[model samples]
Each structure stands twice: as structure tokens, then as C-alpha cells.
Target: MSIQLIHAMNDLTATHKDLLELSKRKTEALTNNKLDEFQALLLEEQKLIRQLEKQEQKRQEAAEAWKDEQHHPAETLTITEILGRLDVEEQKMAEDAAVALTDTIRELKRQEHLNKALLEESMKFVQLSMELVNPSIQSMNYGTASSDKMSGRSLFDSKA
Candidate 1:
């Protein structure tokens, strides 16, 4: 294998480590309600994943060429032939990564939808309770505004 191939593999390994670390940090940010930080970390992780994929492609191509030469000892493969194999491997990796990323992003979106619905439902329950105890809130104008405001009507209303 060429020195370049070794370098590519090493680069991919480093990128993978960075991605894993970023993933952990993102999870921590999520737990701490640091959504902005979590999103930033996610973007950085994705970029690193792409870099890793690119390097892996180069390594795989070089390895395949080395294998082909070993398999056909009577003939030497042209540089172009080796590069062709590498290109094919790189393209395949790109497609696979795209599909994986798409699926993951879709799942995250679905989970976000569910979470939003749950939050809305919880707010509804709280609003219902306030209305039950203070029947005056059911009417727009019954008790003093401050009384309804303090009782949590304004709280849920502001949310809406």
C-alpha cells in the first residue's frame, strides 16, 4: 500500500474520533437544555463524518488496487485503472452516507413532532385545571383581570 493510503486511513480514524466526541457533547447539551450548543455540535459532527467518509474512500480504493495487482501477478494494472476503482468506491460511500443521514434526520424530525404534541397536551391539561377551579375564567369578563392573571390563565394564554 502507498504511504498516501496509510495517511488517508489515519485521517479517517482521527475524524471518526472527533465525530464521536462531538456526539457525546451534543447529548450532554441536550440533557442540560442547551439546545443552541447541541445544534452547533451536531453540525460539526456531520462535517467530520463527511471528512471521514472521504478519507475512507481513498483508502479503500488504494487497497483494492493493491489487491487487484496481487491477484493478477502476470499483468500490471494502469494507474487510471486503480483510480477508476477508487472513484467507484467513493461514489458508493457518498450514496450510502446520504441515505443514512436522510433516515436519521427524518427520525429526529418525527421525534420532535411527538415532543411538541406532548408539550401542547400538557399545557392543555394545566389550562383545564385552572378553568375548573376558577369558573370565572371560563367567561372572558367575570372576575378582576389580576385574579385570573395570577391564577394561571395569563400564563397559558401567553404561551398560545
Candidate 2:
């Protein structure tokens, strides 16, 4: 059971590493403004996320099984707790896997934030360009009260 748990953890770590790589690629796509590539990456990311979810479920089941084997009374078991019951070599393996997974997850989050900022900046640029091309009407209010009626009118007539 401990072996199964360890295997599950390693599998999860591998999947996370894959996801981290994808995130880096996504960042590149966003920076380069490659909409098609970004869309493809998003689809790939969704598939990876689904695989990760399944691996996570398997890990949970393994942990529960290990806990049952150990006769642990708690409703939940932590990796540390599982480590305590493992042999030295197994403990080392689990600890290394956990650390690798944690680091990958942290890096992925940072990359995601960076991508979000880049996307937002891109959107702002597009919006500014659109406004420049077709600006909305605003009140000039430089004339008499009668000019107030023209507040909502466009400066240039499109039908002209």
C-alpha cells in the first residue's frame, strides 16, 4: 500500500511537471499574441488538468488504503503522517516527490499570474485602439445652453 501511495505521488508529480511546461508555453503564446496557439494550449491544458484530477483521486484512494492498513483512526491522513509509517528509503522518496510537486505547483501559479497580467495588458491595448478608431461621443460643453442638446452627437457624421 505504501508503495502504491508512493507511485501515485510520483505520477502526480510527473503530471504537474507536464502542466508546468505547458504553462510556460502558454506564457510565450500570450506574449507573442498568438491567439490560435494560445487557444490550442488552452485545450491541451484542460486535458492535462483532467488527467491531474484523476491522478489526484488515485492518490487519495491509495492514501486511504494505506491509512486503513496502518489502522489509523483519523478520518484523513497527511503525507507527513504517511511518511512516519514508511521505511527510510520510502520516506525519502515520498519527501522528494512532495517537494518536487510543491515547487512545480508554485511555479505554475506564478506563470499563470504573469499570463493573466499579459492578457489584461493586451486587452487594454486592443480597447484603446478600438476607441481611437471609433471613439464614443462626449460633451464638449463650450457653447451656450442650446449646445447641450448636441452632447450625445458624434463629431463626424458616418452617413456623410
Best by TM-score: 2
Model 2 misplaced stretches (Cα beyond 4 Å): 139-160
Give the Cα-based TM-score of candidate 1 against the true structure.
0.43
State TM-scores per candidate. Answer: 0.43, 0.85
lDDT agreement of model 1 with the native: 0.59
Please, what are the lDDT tens digits per residue for candidate 1 over residues 70-152? 47453544433444445566545544543454455465555556545654665687799988878665476666764857885
Best by lDDT: 2
Please give the distance, in angstroms, between residue 84's alpha carbon in candidate 2 and its true position after superposition: 1.4
Q: What does candidate 2's lDDT look like per residue over 13-123, in tens digits?
A: 899889889989998998888999999999999999999999999999998888888999988788888788789999998898888888888988898898899989999
Residue 139 C-alpha lDDT in model 2: 36
Give the per-residue Cα lDDT of candidate 1 at 75. 53
